[model samples]
Target: MKKGIDWRYRISNKEAMMGVVLAILNFIWWYAFAYGLGSRPVKDYTYILGFPAWFFYSCILGFIVFTILVWIMVKYFFTEVPFDVDEYKKEETE
Candidate 1:
């Protein structure tokens, strides 16, 4: 018989781990812009084209790059694989 609680169909630990790694990498890249590459807060221009200078110029590039990276991760890493349930299921297939 099935147990009182079945938590299957939930994201596995591996998926969670990969997501955490992806988030960490994204944060690291953002931090690099803030510190490693020395990106300072813009205070001069109000807007470039139609958006704020900081939003249109400084962060726009990072946003594009990060978006691409995240897209790649989602496309390749976050795949739906069958979870191992041999331990939970019985040999009789009950």
Candidate 2:
């Protein structure tokens, strides 16, 4: 703790938990699409925008979902704390 410093930032437990949940969701989605579906033998399957089924679901769609999640969290869950350095103020006054 330094005098006259007016900066403080910390991640709360709720924020951390939110991040963990999102990460797990991403992992599961990737696993299901890339490993589970992609591993299947090539059959009369279809592709999205020329991308393989696995890549489309695991990467493209997952990217969209992840972006939305991040946007929502940042918009509503984020907190900005205000900091005031009283010691610095008194020093300047004197």
Candidate 3:
């Protein structure tokens, strides 16, 4: 007899893909701020809280934004799956 793909695996794959998408978005955010603002000459640079504008946006703000994004993703998109072998066995039998 052949067994079908497990439900837990599907959930895990979906979550993993979501994580990858988040990571890509984070990289894009960092890249945009780091390169878009930082490419200017030092004399033209602006400061925020004594930090360079690029540094403030790319590092500091990026951290806070991604932290919130991850929190929201986990709270809303992620599922609570049982990792216990017994739970799997019971589901398979059912």
Q: Number of the top candidate by lDDT?
A: 3
Error of 3 at 14 (Å): 0.6
* Candidate 3 error regions (>4 Å): none
Model 2: per-residue lDDT, tens digit, 1-94? 4665443433555677888998999999999999877887778456889988898999999999999999999899976543456764665579
lDDT of each: 0.63, 0.79, 0.95
Ranked by TM-score, top first: 3, 2, 1
Return whichever of 1 and 3 wins on TM-score.
Answer: 3
Note the residue pairs that clash in candidate 2. none
**Per-residue lDDT of candidate 3, residues 1-94 (tens digit):** 2367678898999999999999999999999999999999999999999999999999999999999999999999999999999998987789
| C-alpha TM-score for every candidate | 0.47, 0.70, 0.92
Put down candidate 1 lDDT per residue, 15-67, tens digits, no spaces. 77777887787677666654543445555446657766545534776688768
* Error in Å for residue 76 of model 3: 0.9
Local lDDT at 4 for model 1: 57
Listing every candidate in turn, what is its Cα RMSD in Å to the true structure after a full C-alpha superposition? 6.8, 5.6, 2.0
